[model samples]
Target: MDFDPRLTPARSDLAARRLQARVTAERFVDGTPARVVVGLAPLRRGPRGDARLDTEALAGESLTVYDEDEEGWGWVQLDRDGYVGYLPTHAYMKGDVARPTHRVTALRTFVYPALSIKEPPLDWLTLGARIAGIAERVVDGRAYVITASGGVVVADHLAPLDRVEADPVVVAERFLGTPYLWGGRSSLGIDCSGLVQTALEACGVAAPRDTDLQEAALGTPVDLDPAQWRRGDLLFWPGHVGLVRDATTFLHANAHVMAVSIEPIAAGLARIAAAGAPLRSVRRVERPQ
Candidate 1:
């Protein structure tokens, strides 16, 4: 049996307690539950500073900590997308996972210590970041939400977690021009798969973290011919993914352009073919709009 290392919590020295029957490890223990308390924390491929980033854990996101080293790195699995990686131990609160009451629907917003926007910002939150709101306030005709921890966020930027967008493609369109980032899922920066995953999340879809995982987990496969494509279809290449904006175009956060851009599918096919990564598949996800 093959287990993907990216999602598997088993290392040579130890493994999760639940995986004891499936994996062989020197030790097995139930992992500790935690929640990201910081605005965003980098999840690295390794425990070192120079290690490649695998993804970013958003504020209030749930995680299970499998191992914590003296070096302050925690090996954990993100509960949202099942991504396993190393993150700074102090970036998360070691306790029960947070129960999110609101989700950031805007591309990004600032957090304040007071109800006034004039107050020095405490931090910033990106799209899809979740918060546990305990109260709401209105000042100067603007609404704000008071977090369970006393942080204030503009209510206009948030929505109840149950309030989802109507269209994933329309949600994707909102990220146009976002800077390209290899492992980022935030509006400040995003990668090919992160863009797709973030957009789908807004529509209440649970998408995996990376391209290959997303490809295998999302919608049914369909013909790759451009004419057969629809607005909500997903196009996958070897290490890339994009959403169909319409029949003639698709949108993606590409390293080629170094930003999110809509490109003509005909031009994209030729350019990608020239680069040796042709379109591999098109998947149609049937959902509201």
Candidate 2:
């Protein structure tokens, strides 16, 4: 049977011939678990810097290293989303994976060596990056969350591990004006499905990374009429998806505007129709009653 490389793990039978054969021959089964060390490690389609960027692994995210090529690229599967791709082997460090105690809620935050904001940041963390808090410190009346890795992050930028945002739309709207990047999953640059996935994940809702998988798995189908749509509804088109801002408006990260923007549902529909990618489906994620 045919398999989509994007959705299938490298250990599966449908993976590439070399990977399948390697797994079948018992050369490797479960790969080594590692943590991303850089700000944003590019996951590429091939074991080269010039290869197509499929996705990204944020700092502190867990991944399983399957194999490494001579070029120093490691084939891995992202633990959070199960996305398989190649990233430089040097970008990962195998060690005790700290249990995350909080998640970054800001578009981006800095990790400082001290509690003072004036101290130069040691690293930058994008939204959704998980952090393990080893201790809390107050320096000169400023509070900071100290991570197990000896990095300090602002307390206000992180939320407790169990805290889930009340509304996905509210979470999505915070990224308004973020620039569009085809495979980006951060507020610095994001795409249609990335925006949706980021928003839903903040609300403690799991989501797939790609539009087609999201369309197939997220939420349940609802009426296609814009009039029937409510806030937090998802509208899908070929290769795209958007969050319903309200009864008549939808928000999306679009290449047309090159940024996240809100547009009337009717106008968006007309524009997409003009491009021959008409509205395909409407899905509503049922909320707690």
Candidate 3:
């Protein structure tokens, strides 16, 4: 049987105990749960610093850790999307996770030591990172949410988890000008699928973390004609995906521009087709009910 390594929590020597019957391994153990404690932790393909980044573990999200290797890397799967990778043990807390009350809505925001904005920043969080608010305070006519971990960040930068945007395209527009980072999941830097995933996620849509998975699962197929494209319609090529801003324009984070940018659909398609990857499919996403 074939399995996707990105979603499989198994290896020849160690595998999730739940898969004992389906996979053969030298050992099998149920995974331990942990919560991300750092602003952002790189989820890597391997345990070394030079390994390729698979994605990111955002602060406050829980993960199932199968192994805490000797070198301080945790073989884990992110709870949000089941993406399997290796994260440094220092980035997460060992135990159960707290339910997050609020999610970061800003492109980025600083964590402060106290309620005062004058305090030197302790850390930073990007859009999609969640936190449990222990208290709320109004200081100097500004609102602040005191995190359960005691960090102070602007209240306006966060929204209750239930609050969602009206459109994913609007959310994607916010990322324009962000530097492109392969495997990046934050507004600080992002990739083609990362932008789409982040945008749709903001609008309360659960999304897969990669282009191939997203293209296959996100939305039902639609006619491939550009004229049929509408806001939030996804366009796919061999290894890339982008959102249709309108009938005329599209938005994507691509290596070509090395940043999130919008361009005419015909131009983007022409350039990509010229490079040998023609538009393969169009998928229209439905608005959340």
C-alpha lDDT score of every prediction, in listed order: 0.91, 0.85, 0.91
Candidate 2 structure quality by residue, lDDT tens digits, 207-241? 88999999999888999877788899999999999
Instruction: Give the C-alpha lDDT of model 2.
Output: 0.85
> How many Å off is the CA of 111 in candidate 1?
0.8
The TM-score of candidate 1 is 0.97
Which residue pairs show collisions in model 2? Answer: none
Candidate 1 per-residue lDDT, tens place, 1-289, comes to 5799999999989999999889989999899999998888999999998899999999989999999999999999999999999999988988765488999998889899999999999989998999999999899999999998889999999999989997888888888999999999888889999999989988988899888888998999989788888897999999999999987888999999899999999999899989999889888877654
Candidate 3 segments exceeding 4 Å error: none
lDDT tens per residue, model 3, 1-289 = 5689999999999999988888888999998888998899999999999999989989988999999878999999998988999999999997755778999999999899998999999999999999989899998899999998889989999999999988998888989999999999887889998889889989988999999999999889989888777899999999899999987999999999899999999899999999999999999888688
- Ranking the candidates on lDDT from highest down gives 3, 1, 2
- Please give the lDDT score for candidate 1: 0.91
Worst 10 residues of 2 by lDDT: 9-18
For model 2, the stretches where C-alpha displacement exceeds 4 angstroms are 11-28, 287-289
How far out, in Å, is residue 162 in model 1?
Answer: 0.5
Estimated TM-score for each candidate: 0.97, 0.92, 0.98
What's the residue-level lDDT of 266 in candidate 3? 87
